[model samples]
Structures are given as structure tokens and as C-alpha cells.
Target chain A: MKNLNEISTRLEIAKKKIKKNQIKDNGTNAASLGKALKISTELVASVVVGSTIGFLLDNWFDTKPLLTICFFILGVVAGILNVIRSAKKMHKINKYRKR
Target chain B: MSLNPMHQFEVYRLGPEINLGSINLSFTNASLFMTISASVILFFLFIGTKKKSLIPSKIQLVSEMSYSFVAKMINDTAGSSAKPFFPFIFTLFMFVLFCNMVGMLPYSFTVTSHIIVTFVLASIVFVGVTIIGFIKHGLKYLELFVPKGVPVILLPLIVIIEIISYLSRPVSLSVRLFANMMAGHTMLKVFGGFVISLGLLGGWLPLGFSVALTGLEILVAFLQAYVFAILTCIYLNDALNLHH
Candidate 1:
């Protein structure tokens, strides 16, 4: 509920405390914070969907070798799909907000 | 040996290249794109929350949450002295959050996964803090390396160690974020690749792992962003307290 200025002011104080203690990045928090967290379900779906296409392509080309190519392309498509899905989610969330 | 995992850090060409200087800036690498993604998110957040009225909406709620979260962290860890530095801290949070979150996307780049991006942010903190320290304390800022209450004999040695450690903050700060992001993403990528290569015979296990891993990665994205911002808060505490 604090104003932006008040919030920023508190952060400045915290920054100083960190410096004085020689606060290293090690274990500042409970566990190491990393990208392993915050992954979306859509991302997992993307890869699965990509793999399905690749599996089908491998079957279609009458050669399993094409699976490799199909999978590679699928990966890119999946990445793009992730972006689209994320954008849609953001938009949806925005729509949900009122007032 | 195979290419260093770090070698994957270079920028590449994607579309018609444009020359800004001696270097061509076209197909930017994962790092550059992550930076752009962060900026885009910031832009939208700004647009969404810019409006102020009798009622607040979803974007406003998020914006408010982000603002208060940092503020509370600062108050709890560093106190009121952190006020002036909120903007920098906010930017850091957004940037790290974006990088970590975007990296969770399939095959998308994780800029924070590299040391360079994290280093840039850390360095800014270092330079900013150092300047602020000196500005506030003037010549007295030198006292930060020498703590009170230590035994007389150990004073000199302790002071030396403190200075060395103080100087290393930038490297440590940068590495913590970078290593976490990089290691997590690499594991995800490897597991993801396997989920495909193993065929149906072995695919089930890796697919299951991928789902769990993806869920974990999302949590991490928020965590890293919070950690990075909170650390910045801690740093601000030192400057204000002048306890050293």
C-alpha cells in the first residue's frame, strides 16, 4: 500500500546494509534462486507437441533419419509457440484486471 | 574438449544485418533478445499501470504488488535509507525476472543465464554504491573496510580482507544469478532434447521429468528475480548504515 517513493526509499536503506556486511551472493536466500522456477505449462506442452510432429514426420518420410530434422524444426516452432502463448496469457491477465 | 558451454554466448545474424558501428547488429543472440524481452515487458507493465483511478485492475494489482514487494524487502533488510535507490532496484528486478521467465520458454534464450548480463547489473550496483558511499561519507567512506570492536592486532589483516571481499561483490553478485540461470536451463535443454530423442521406448520418463522441471523453472524465475532485488536492498543497507 506504500507509495512508490516510500518503497524506493526503503530499498536504498537495504542496499547499504548489504554492502556493509560484505554480503556475498551465496545463500542470501533459503535456496539458490534460478530459472528452474517459473516455467510455464505451455512450455512443456510445446516440446511434447513438437516431439509428436517429429515422430509423425519420421514415420511419414519412410525414414527415421527425418525425425532428427523434424525435431529440430519442431523445437523452433515450439519456441515461437511459447512466445505466442505467453503473450496470450499476459493479454488475458490484463483483461481480468478492472478498475 | 567440446566447445565451452560459454561459447554459446555469441550474437548471430538472423535477418538483414544492420551496422551501428564496426559491429553488425542483426540476428541478436539469446542475451540480446532476453534484454529486449525484459524491455518489452516493462513497457507493457508501464502502460497498464500508468493509469490511476478510484479502482485498480489486474495490471494495476500486479504493478502495485511489485512496487510494494521491493519496498517491504528494503524496509525489512535495509530500512528507510534504501528509498533513493528504488528505481535501480526495480529495474534490476524486472530485468532479472524477465530473463529468468523468458528463458523458461522452449528454445528461447535466457540472457541472465550468461555472466555478462548479470555482471553488467552487478557492476552498476558496485559503481553506484561506491559513488553513493563516498558522496555521503566523503573521505570517511574509507572506514567501511575497518570494523569496530575487533582486536587491535587483527585490525590490519581484517581490514585488508574486508577490502578484498568488498571489491569482489560485483563478481559474486553477477555469478550467483548467472550460474543459477545457466545451470537450470542447460539441464532443461538436455532433458528436453532427450524427451524427443528417446522415442516412445524411453520418452515417457524424460517427458515426465520435463513437466516437473518446467514447473520448477517457473518458480525459479520468480525466485531469482526476488533474490537479485533483495540483494540490492542489502547493499543499500551497508551504504546507509556505514557500520563498517
Candidate 2:
């Protein structure tokens, strides 16, 4: 009975250690959720900021629609660029994670 | 008892409305919930950490788990250079987490569902990151917008694109949190109304959906808070390291 109790106690300790380690492992996975949520926001934000800046500049320069049109295109490019960079970062993380 | 789903979001003065000069400082349900969230966070953390034990109590375990979670997030996303900002990031995470979780309660208001609140938080991060970038790198912070290995001919265009992306950070960050919370809560409310109006026999379907959605929202509540903090870490990383 004493030996059996010792064995069971050891098993419980091992189980607890495994649980702790699992929690730590899960942290890295949670970050992917954050990454997924972020990409779209980054794209939308770039366009919005680009157009706002363009609209303001056009108003200041008294050139209606010209700057806005230019900025809108620039914003789209910027959004694409932002998305590309984040995707690249994600790729790097995935590679590291694989290792 | 009009069965209006939108009524859940209504804000009304809770006490004597106070106006200080040009500003209206009326206390509303939103403000009340914010206070509740903040206090709840404080209480949780305080009690959780007060007993420093090798073998933690359940409360201490929760406190420690959250601490390590945020710590790991910062270290992974922002690197050790962002350690000094841990308190700010941790507080932000807990506050948002509490607000989100508390809002899930029946008859509770979600402070984070509002753009004004999330916008303020995002703007603070935006301004802080910008200031940090400028202070750390001086004029070179502008280099953040200038991609490396670009041809001289395309430098100006690339820079403009970069600047647009950089400027979009706050709007995207704030809107993402606000929209997620707002949409989730609205969907829950809408389904809840269906459960009520349909009567018990017909209400089971919507009730089941409401149950599932509540579970999903709980997950989302935790996730949005994590995203908020992690993104802040990423921005801080960019500022601190000047990483492209």
C-alpha cells in the first residue's frame, strides 16, 4: 500500500508538471489569433489614413479631388505593403515555431 | 417593455448630470461599468498576488498565469527591450479583459463596444509609440517609413505608402476592438430577443444559438484583450528596435 501510494503521488506530480508546460506552450498559439485579427485592420487603416492625408493636403493646396485620387491609390499600395510585411513576419515566426 | 434589442446599448445619466465649463461630465452606465471593470481588476490582482506562495492557491494561480501570459507575449512580440512597458501593457490587458468579461453579464454595459473609448486607448498608444520612436531614433524614426533595398527612383512612392500604413495603426487598432465587441454584443442581443418573442416552445433554437454565442463571445473577450496588448507590444517593438 505504501509503495502504491508513492507511485500514485509521483504520477500526480508528473501530471501537474505536464499541465504547467502545456499552458506555456499554449501562449505561443494564442499569438496567432492576435496576428489574424491584426492583418485586416492594418489594411483598412492604411487606406483610411492615406485618403485623409490626401483630402487634407488637397484642401490646403486648393486642388479638389486630385490629391484625394492620388492618395487613395497610394493608400491601397500602402495597405498591400503592410499586409505583405506582416505576412512575412508571420512566415518567419512559423519557421521558428517549426524548429 | 418594448422588446428592442438596441435598448441594451442605451446610455442615460445615472445621477445628477454635471457640466464642468464646456465639458459634460455626466455619469452614465458606460462610466459605471468602466469603474466596475477597473475595480474588479484591481481586486482580482491584489488578492491573487497578496499570498506569495511556492504552491499557489487558485487565485494566485490565476494571477500568476495571467502575469506569465502577458510577460511571454511581450517577450515574444516586442523582445526584452520592451520590458519597461510591461506594467502599462499588463494593466491595459487586465482592464480590457475585465471590461469585456463583465460586459458579458446579463444587464451589463460593454464599455469597450464604444469607439470613443477604444479610440482614446489606441490614440494614446499611437502618440506614445510615435513619441518613443522619435525620442529613441530622432530624425531616423522617419526612416521607419523608408523601406530598405528600394531603388532611388521609387523611394518617394514607397515612403508615402509606408507613411500611410504607419498612420493607419491607431484607427485600425481601435476600430478592430470596438467593432468586434459591438458586433458580438449586438448579435447576442438580437438572438436573445428572438428567444423572448418566440415563446418557450419556439425559442429553443435561438436559445441554443445564444448559448453557443455566449461561449464564443467569452473566447472572443479573452482574445480581443490579448490582441490589443500584443499589438501594442508589436508597435512598441517597432519603436524600440526600429525594425522595418
Q: Write the per-residue lDDT of candidate 2 for residues B1-244, one digit (tens) a residue.
A: 4477667777889999899999999999999999999999889989999989766789999999999999998999999989999999999999999999999999899999999999999999999999998999999998887878999999988877777888888999899999889999989989988999899789999999999999989888999998889889989999999856
How well docked is model 2, in DockQ terms? 0.69
Candidate number of the best lDDT:
2
Docking class of 2: medium
Candidate 2 TM-score to native: 0.91
Off by over 4 Å in 1: A1-99, B1-10, B14-27, B50-53
All candidates: TM-score: 0.65, 0.91
Report chain B TM per candidate. Answer: 0.87, 0.97
Query: In candidate 1, what are the lDDT values of residues A1-99, reduced to their tens digit?
Result: 467678678889999998889776564343422222212323443444455556777788777867756564555454454446446644563576432
Give chain A TM for each model in order. Answer: 0.40, 0.73
Clashing pairs in 2: none
lDDT for each residue of candidate 1 in B1-244, tens digit (9 for 90 to 100): 1123444444566667789989766666763676678777778688767897535778887788888888877777678877877777887888788777777766467778777778888889888888888888898988877778889998865664455445545655676677667777777767767877798899899889978988877877778788678767767778878872
